[model samples]
Target: MAKPRRGVQFQHRGSNHHNGRRPSISESDSVSEPGSPTGAAMNGKLETSKEEDESPPQSEYEKKKQNFITRAIWTLVMMAAFFTAMFSGHLYIIAIITGIQVMSFKEVIAIANVPSRAKNLRFTRSLNWYFLGTTMYFLYGESVIYYFKHIVLVDKVLLPFATHHRFISFMLYVIGFVFFVGSLQKGHYRFQFTQFAWTHMALYLIVVQAHFVMNNIFEGMIWFFLPASLVITNDIFAYICGIAFGRTQLIKLSPKKTVEGFVGAWVCTIFFGFAMTNVLMRYKYFICPVNDLGANIFTGLECTPNPVFIPQAYHIPSIVTDIPLPGSLHIPSIVHVAPMQFHILVFATFASLIAPFGGFFASGLKRTFKVKDFGESIPGHGGITDRMDCQFIMGFFAFMYYQSFIAVYKANVGDVIQTAIQGLDHEEMVEVVKGLSKHLVNQGVVQETVLECWTGVVGNRR
Candidate 1:
């Protein structure tokens, strides 16, 4: 063993353990001058600082392994809860989404609340929550009116609220805005404004994007599940491929992301989407639009399958047909595939290529805050926001894409009822109802006696 350096002394492990006795001044190499109370206090602070600077007892790898185990457990738990909600009914899925939005918004808003609390700004968190509630009210109200207008339009209690929803939402936001401005302190104006902007950002990112996701669920569970599943599949394959073959870095924001992993995951996701779509299409519960929130996997739902879900044949392009090939090989002139498969390719591509940017955005945000995670809500998995960063963007894209490309637009019973109720006077409405009843009578759908009864009732009411 080498000799000890000058001015450095090593003590035996048991030397300081005797009788719980405090070490002498010289033994501790005291910086305090001869019992000066101030010096003692300074020395205590120094010791505290040193203790804090010491490494944690757990090894780095041990900590990482423990975190991994916790993360795995939570992931399984979340999956189980998600599948359970999915099978429960549309309402349960909507509830889960609503809860996720609230929790994610809380996690995001909490990050900025530190300064507000330091300044004793009483309404910072209040304003954030107020904005969130207002946004949810507006969004949920819009969705309810759009999807469930048949239910709401007939109900006297909900009709006025449904019709004036946008105005109500706007007024609610204005109230919050005015309150925020009034509560701004002299020195905290900048911080208050920043918080206001931050709150809006969170609302848009977490609440607004999530609103589209909820709408996707209403359109059909597949619209929600397929896109979500694609993102998750890509994420998993990306990790697997990265560990297996990752070499070149893909992005500066997420250092671990690699080009090999990205492309490999994209390929895997496309295949996964195709297979999952085929599986999901077989079930009316997943494929049909949500006409009844109470309907579940067991209860099922009924709708004519969308045209995209029907298999169609496409002729091979002449350019491809003309390509030289081996004499033994034959390329079919026509191939059968559901148009939805073509759409799935696009969805998978977006999930694999674009959605990861959302995660990168979250990573950059954490770096800006100098935080390793958003919060400890999920143990090793970090906050809900962290896990859902990509899902928000993915769901938003799915909604827009479905609307533009896949959704069939046509009038339904709700539209006819709404038009009759809103556009016609009482006499005109009676006349319209009588005309419909007469048409039904001629079609043999309603008996002639029923039409007579309806005619008599309408004329008397008029």
Candidate 2:
């Protein structure tokens, strides 16, 4: 610029200057040197890019296969746990059901609890759990009183509670209601009331239905096992059929469901239920009611078999024989089957046709909440409530069905013992014993000498 140098050209290589030419070998080496910070950062980025290029993404089929394998493993584990609890004893089964109820309640409550709604109310969470506890106490107490009336009524300490169980339950509920009302804040009425309603819905759906399930178990393990098995079998077959030949949609509530699956499952469930009943009827442990509360599967129990389990023979009807045969020959048939088999057919029919509505109800609930599952408690199975939806309806139906149609009313030793001791005072009890002894003597069931000795002993005690 000073003199417009003709043959000589001037260049600057400052930190901010650019020559507009490719760098020399020495300059390039300096920029890529391992000791330089810029070189180290570039090297890191290059290695990251290389890794990304080397690793391939998983295909959709592979992902689905992996998920299925995971689900299968977890299902096998759950079944193992379930059968283990079943073989343990009735008490263990009750405990498992109770635990499931609590977990289900927790999941449902969590869904209902919106953070925006729960921000200010202090007692909302506490009140929910309190309601759960009170409801469980009431329902469980009713079951214990009814099933173990003899033992509970005889104990002086527990007598008052047993006698006024319903009143106690009501009073407990009233106390909780008062507490909830008192704790309501000035601006939080709407939120608190919504939570209140939510809590009660959970109680009805999870707890009340679970009470019926407990009753089914005490009535007989068969009542609980058969219905539950039928529902599970139906679910399995429905899924299998749906995948194999499903084309036409069954319902909008569950798009994955197909008409083919629904019909196929019903047919398979009926046959499975009939076959399962035949096998279970052979075991007295499954068919017998829990007479001794203290007895377990290991100690074993003894009871007269329900008449339904006993096989009986019947002749084929004449109407069937009236059918014209090709060769003018008639074949007489005698069928030998248990009465309970026919009863099982009824139960299986209901389980297949009606119980699945419970699943539809759950699906609607999930869609309402914008959730794919109730919770992740069971890996691939969702929450306990999710798995037990149809089971709850099935259990309630089984309990009602047994009480109305199948339950026997024979008086057992516990009934007699309760009537004798609980209905009489001390002196009346002694008199009743003396009268029984005298009656036995007269009937030649005991000797007069032995009766006199027993009477003398009773007199001395008095």
Please give the clash total of every predicted structure, in order. Answer: 0, 0
> Which of the numbered candidates is closest to the native, going by highest lDDT?
1
Q: Local error of candidate 1 at 368, Å?
A: 0.6
> Candidate 1, TM-score vs. the true structure?
0.87
Compared with the true structure, all predictions reach lDDT values of 0.90, 0.86
- TM-score leader: 1
Ten-residue stretch with the least lDDT total in model 2? 9-18
Q: Write the per-residue lDDT of candidate 1 for residues 1-462, one digit (tens) a residue.
A: 998687654454344334655666653554436366666776788679879889578889999999899999999999999999999999999999999999999988878766635458888878888999999999999998888889998899999998788999999999998998889888877878888899899999999999999999999999999999999999999999999999999999999999999999999999999999999989999889999888999999999989999999999987887788888776778999999989999999999999999999999999988888888888788898989999999999999999999999999988888888888888887788888989999998989999889878767865
lDDT of 2: 0.86
| TM-score of each prediction | 0.87, 0.84
| lDDT at 84, model 2 | 83
RMSD of 2: 5.8
